[model samples]
Target: MTPTQATAARRSKISPERAQELYAAVLDELREHGYEALTMEGVAARACCGKSTLYRQWRTKPQLVAAALRAHRRGTLAAVDTGTLAGDLREAARIAAGTSGRDTRLTQALGLAVLSDEELQAALREALVEPELAAFGAMVQRAADRGEIAAGHPALEFLPAQLMGVLRIRPVLEGRYADAAYMERFVDASVLPALGLAPAP
Candidate 1:
């Protein structure tokens, strides 16, 4: 089909609930079979929808997977407000630790494929990375406003990387997922100290 026709096909509305179902099916397929092995036909079969429907909606595997990742986004960090930067960072750490295993596995599954596929890389950033970065920025801004941390503290720039890096790296370095306790300790030991703050009592 022509580009215009493809764009029109993509504009066809699917219910929010149905879209979520399809997205879940796509994630499940990705988890069970890494990106290289995932197929539009498999997603169609798993979602119990017609293959043509998948094609009409997303046009290709990269588009479909991107949509799925976007739809699956949960703004977990955006909700954190513990009244202090240290408390907020600890809460964020706890939350990240809670899902570290599942998320790490998903990241690993999509690792090389996402690096090569611009569409997937952009989707991952939009769906996962950017949201968290925004949330952390908000948290840091709030802390600065409250005078809990200096506005120009260098560590502020690295907060997201510090938290996300630990979550992604623990499994690689220790062969164990970063748990809530470990994450909380990390915030106390590494993150807070870097900002010249101490863990909240």
Candidate 2:
């Protein structure tokens, strides 16, 4: 379609506020039914919009859900500066444990599907993984600058894997979501020792 036609089409449909409301429905559907089982019709029904509206906005379920994911993306760990690497890591662990349980479930739900679906994988990376990775990298770099860790410390290098691994696995292992207290314990018992540092005094 022509640019004017596209603009007209978009203008004729839902408001941005309305679209935001619909995106919530999309995510809820994804959480409830998973990616493979989610349908455009289901999202529309939940959003109380016409299926044609969604189809007009996004030609396929993947595109619509990708948009929803992007719309819902937020800063996962954008403001975590605790003055010391150990302090920061402990704080990070706490944040991850509290916030990541649902994300872990979502990732598990999308597991093998993400591997085979390029669009879905890209959406997942952009919406979920990249922000947290950037935050973790910045946290580590700040720690190095502050002399909390060696520039080439092994723990610094492996920190992301360690934290993310525990976040993903804890639910499976114990049939319980990791919580702040559990994360603090993990930091004290494991992360601090790996970094060759004692817990904060």
Candidate 3:
């Protein structure tokens, strides 16, 4: 079909606001009921729409879940410019912690579902992981361009890993939360020194 025809077909599916409403309802359903129990019928009923409506938007369960993830992709790291590299790194760490904290339960469900399904894993990565990585890559690239770090610096690729590491390990390691204070300290003590960027004078 032509581009215009494709556009028309998509428009006929659902309005943007309605699609967002459906996506939000689907995510809530996934959160309350594990992905194993999540069904398009249930999502349709919850969203007060019809099964055909759900099908029109997303033909498969993974596709529907993927759309839900994409629709609600505002996981922290939205606004993270603090002038100094140390400041930006601190905010970046907090953003990582905040994003996980905000969506941990739901993502846990997604994780469970992906463990048993390959298609779901691919869908999840494309829908959620890729976008997040893309956003972070852009920031890291900008930092490099700003001469904060050399392009080939080992620390560049390690930044996201550090952010994720702290979030993933805090509760398990210290039996404590990775709060903003902890995130800030991680930047000050560990992240900054690693990047060769000393703390503010």
Q: If scored against the real structure, what TM-score would every candidate get?
A: 0.86, 0.79, 0.78
Which 10 residues in a row give candidate 1 its minimum summed lDDT?
Answer: 3-12
Model 3 spans > 4 angstroms off: 1-13, 73-79, 172-177
Whole-structure CA lDDT of model 3: 0.74
Question: What lDDT score is found at residue 165 in candidate 2?
Answer: 86
Quantify all predictions' global Cα lDDT against the true fold.
Answer: 0.84, 0.78, 0.74
Residues 1-201, model 3: lDDT tens digits: 953355347646678888888888988898888899999999989999889877765667997887687667554464676666677677776666665564555666675677889888877777666766776676767777788877777876777777767776776677766777788888889888988988644
lDDT of 3 at 153: 77
Q: Give me the runs in candidate 2 sitting further than 4 Å from their true place.
A: 1-20, 51-75
Top TM-score hit: 1
Model 1 spans with C-alpha error above 4 angstroms: 1-12, 70-75
| Backbone clashes in model 1, listed as residue pairs | none
